[model samples]
Target: MNLISFITKHSQLPVKGVENTVALLNEDCTVPFISRYRKERTGNLDEVQIAAIVNFKAQFEALEKRKSAILKAITEQDALSAELKSKIEAAGDLTTLEDLYLPYKKKRKTKAETAIKNGLQPLAKIIFGQRNDEIDYEASKYLNDAVPNEDDALEGARHIISEWINERSDIRNLIRRQLERFAMITTKVVSTKKEEEKAQKFRDYFDWSESLSRCPSHRLLAILRAENEGFIRVKIEIDDDKALNNIENRLIKANNATTPHLQLAIQDAYKRLLYPSLSKEILRSAKEKADESAIQVFSKNLKQLLLGSPLGEKRILAIDPGFRTGCKLVCLSAQGELQHNETIYPHPPQNDSKGAIKKISSLADAYKIEAIAIGNGTASRETEQLIKRIQFKNPIEVFVVSEAGASIYSASKIAREEFPNYDVTVRGAVSIGRRLADPLAELVKIDAKSIGVGQYQHDVDQNQLKNSLDTVVESCVNTVGVNINTASIPLLSYVSGIGPKLAENIVAYRNENGAFGSRTEIKKVARLGNKAFEQGAAFLRIKNAKNPLDDSAVHPESYPIVQKMVKDQGLALSEIIGNKEVLKKIDLNKYCTESVGLPTLEDIIKELEKPGLDVREKAKVFTFNQNIRTINDLSAGQLLPGIVNNITNFGCFVDIGIKESGLIHISNLSDSFVKDVNEHVSLHQQIIVKVLEVDIPRKRIQLALHK
Candidate 1:
């Protein structure tokens, strides 16, 4: 299929409109530019659709390049047939084409090549043909070969015939497919060194066997961990009888007289060559699949963490906990405005306890703070204790905010813009406070993977991990929407059409010209262009501003239509926005099209149903154990309440007031079989559990779910 048509057929975007979009991207036009101004040309494809087209187009071009490479590789061997060349050229994926080319590709010297060079090719062919009862005759024909000095020429011919069977691509392919189907992955301890005794985590993996599809990512990763630590040698195995019989069936006819010898040769080939090669391929496939799965889990956790609710329109004092260097404190106004910044050494400051207490108390009093946001960092708990001791007449609530990616955000360009004259440490404190106030907006500023919300995140494929995480962020950002006027560059950057550069431009424009009066006013932002506005406008909110619908998710293009709907109800836009009667009367199909479907229209209707509503409310605070600091402190049968930080295929990790989270295995998630942990528990969910077991030295805590 032609690239544009292919994209149209496969993509969730408008096909015909994206053609021009793709051309612009190919010409190096940025997403921001095309999404904003070229709406009429693209039939109003937003930033998301435009970006999808760009990605698909690049992939299409790469496939063409791969096809050319495959043809060149085959043509070089002078064995390219018209039909094979056409088939390879038409192949969509590399794996399919590679399977077709496997036989003809250049290879290392094999026994068949040796036999061919030794002039036993004729005898080898005769036996491979499986002719009627002619094994002895075929062996006699090989007597003149250099190895013919052996007493039995027939035995020599058998060896040559065996090599031929091994070299046949059809035979190898049949064997590989059969083995993959029947194979069971076997993981075992190497037992080569005493190191495994010290590797307690791997002791349980001494001899684990799992079917390919049923093998979970975490389990595979565990075995890989053992292998990396030099504690285990892992293997993939197929039933020997099944594997051998499949190969024999393909190579030897049932009525053939030489079937026994062919079976022996096939068995020998499998032992010498096929088993090792196919085993490695299976392992590689299994690893790739496992990595994909792990990346998905990590992506889900990161997304939920990044999209955690924001405490909208609240003044906050965010403190980044520290000891010798001292804690950095920054206060933000109710509108996320930076009001004050300072440093306080709650520990070792001026070597006086009274002075440290006075410093933080004064700042809290001056800021009229409602909540004290303490960063969960190196000296977090100590900082929490310090805040608790200073019991104000106001009795402010203390929240231990995760400071996972605060440092990264603080050093980022957006941070520099937000706190131009402030040091990175000072910016970090502001970030921590803002995170408490608006977790989603503040966390979006940091890299999703760096959020520390998932298991083995750093070990997964970074690119795949990044893509999955970005998708989650995109979905979350779009779902919640952003305020165009108040959103930071980092927050705006993730909105539909708006990206890093465009988001910066919008923020800079706002800084230079003041708050956006209307979502349409964003067009004035330098370099934002049309594409940026089209994608971003629908997501950005303009509170209590001109055109009340602007504060809602209803896009500017759909504003008139909504107004028309409201007018049809004999009312103005504001009168009908929150009125259930007016909303019920509106038909989403009136606005539905190939570009903006019923789903998009329904979302707009829902937004209007709750106009200018703040999505973030106080999420239920999870209780952490007061005594437990880590897994080592836990014992069996101890019940604890903790926040569910992440969920995976095999288990859910509960941060039970400890540095290390305890795992509730899948079997424990419910009395029934829990196929997916995410279905049972979500990120930030509070759960109670009983400690099933804890290995003190290993620092592993096994937990069981509480009803």
Candidate 2:
């Protein structure tokens, strides 16, 4: 099939839609740009659907490349029969293609090749035909120096027949299907490493046995990790007798004297060839599936965390909490510029609460701090309690934020460039505070994997994980529009079609030329062209510009349409913007043109109603039970408020005011069956859960969600 036909069949999208999408992608259109602006062309396909089509198209092309290479290799060997060529050409997936080419594949010499060289081809042919009456006589006639006796000749004949059975596509395909359906995975601890300290974490999986198909993605990854570290030995297997019988029924012709030779050949083929090769392939495939599942989960969690609630622009005081190291504090303006920095020790070793409170209150008064953000690391609870006790001029909100990856960001090149004079501790405090004000803007500076809201992140394929996480970040950034005037370079880099270099140029132009007064000024940035503007204009918002549409998602290319709407309504540009009653009453179809269809018009109407609106909810304050500080404080059946910190295929981890997060398995997410843990819980979602069990030695805590 052709590329468009193949893509259409797999994606279930219209032929025209697939054709247009492929054309747009080939022309260098980004997913966010196409999904937002080219809705009419793609039948309103979302970014996810468009990305799926692109991935499928790439796979189809790769398979074709592999097919060409295989055909060339077989033809070079002078073994390319018409029937073989036809079968290879008709194959759909890699497995089928590889199976069809197995017989022609060149390999090192084996018993079968040796036997064939010893003049045993005729006896093997006779046994394979299974119609000869004098099988022993046929075998004896093949004796030579290499095969001195009838027994030796018969053995060689069986070896040759075994290879013939092993190479048949029909037999190999059936056996592969069987292995996929009934394979079992088992693990045992290495005797020498059983009591080692490093292996203690995987102790529960030492003697684990589970059906390969039913294993959870996280569990399988953990098992593989154990095997990789030499703590356990893993095996993928099926019933040998059943597999041999399956081949016997497919290959054996009849129950005659030759049947005994056939049975011996079947056993030899299975033991020596078929089972070992196919089992390895099955394991590799299963691991790939597991990797995909885990990566998808990580992607979802990262997206949610990146899009978490923002507190909007506000002057803030951020604190990186510690006991002996002291809490590093910084004051930031609404634009997140550092105004002041200091270190305060309110927890033990220097429990001068009165002096610390005085210092914090004086800084708040001096800098007009509107809110307080404290990192949820060592001594966070005490710092929060102390902040609440202080009497300030205004009621400043206190938020306990996750400090994961903050240190990584502090040591990063971005942080060093942004704050050349400040220390790493000061930079970390600033990031903590900036994330509370606007998460998407500050998070883009740090690596997604270091954010710590995922499971099995370090174990998954690195390139696949990066692609998935980058897509999620790109999607989130585009969804919540960027402020072109005040956004940092990292934030601007995620705008469609804009990479790091262009983002830097945009920032430099703004710095030299002042804030962007109009959207047209963006084109003046060096190296920016028409294509980049077209792809990135809609997602980049300029607040309070000379033209009102510039602050909204309305692309400048559609300026004529907007002007027509304003003239028809007999209203000024500012008057028509944010006029919900007027926008809601207007019929978009009357203004739809051949170039701008209903999809485009509908989006314009929506933007006019709520110009430059943020889709994320406002940040909220959550409080855990004061008495519970760690797992030791938790008791069975006691309910406590917590926030989800990480999610995996098996369960989610929650922070219930403890250093060690608690686990609520999929079974305990709700009373009913839950096929997916994310359906019941989300990243950073606050809820009440009951403690089910706690192990002090292992530092494990189990929780169950309340009804």
Please state every model's RMSD to the true fold in angstroms.
Answer: 5.2, 2.0
- Judged by lDDT against the true structure, how good is candidate 1? 0.74
lDDT of 2 by residue, 1-707 (tens): 67888788788988888999999999999999899999989989989999888888888898899999999999999999998888888788899998888888897998889999999978898888887877888788888899999889989999999899889888888778888999999999999999999899999899998898888788889999999999999998899999998898888878777889989999999888898898888888888889899999999998899899999999999999999989999999999889999999888899878889999999999999999999999999889989989999987989998888899999999999999998999999999999999988989899999998777788888988998889889999999989988988999999998888999999999999999988888999999999998999888888888888888888788888888888888888788888887777777788887668989888998888888889999999888898987678888899999999999888999999888999998999988899989899999999899899998998999999887
Q: What Cα-based lDDT does every candidate model obtain?
A: 0.74, 0.89
- In terms of TM-score, the best-performing candidate is 2
What is the RMSD of candidate 2? 2.0
Q: Least accurate stretch of 10 residues (summed lDDT) in model 1?
A: 149-158
Per-prediction tally of clashes: 8, 0
Candidate 2 clash pair list = none
How would you encode candidate 1's per-residue C-alpha lDDT over 1-707 as one tens digit per residue?
A: 57887678668667668777877776555565455545656777876787678767777788778778878888898989999987887676555666667666677887666666667666656666777486665566556646564334444456666655555657667767866677787776766753645666678778778786577788888788778778878778778787777777676765666666666667777887778877787778777788888877887787667667555566678888887888887887987788987777657644445676887788778888877788877777677777777857676677777788888888988788777898999888888888878788888878887777766676677777787677678767766778887887778888877778888888888889888888778888888777667667877888779788888766787776677677777887778878887798787777656566665567677878897676555643333566776666778888888777777878888777666778888998898977778888888777788999887766778898898
Supply the TM-score for candidate 1.
0.83
My TM-score estimates for the predictions, one after another, are: 0.83, 0.96
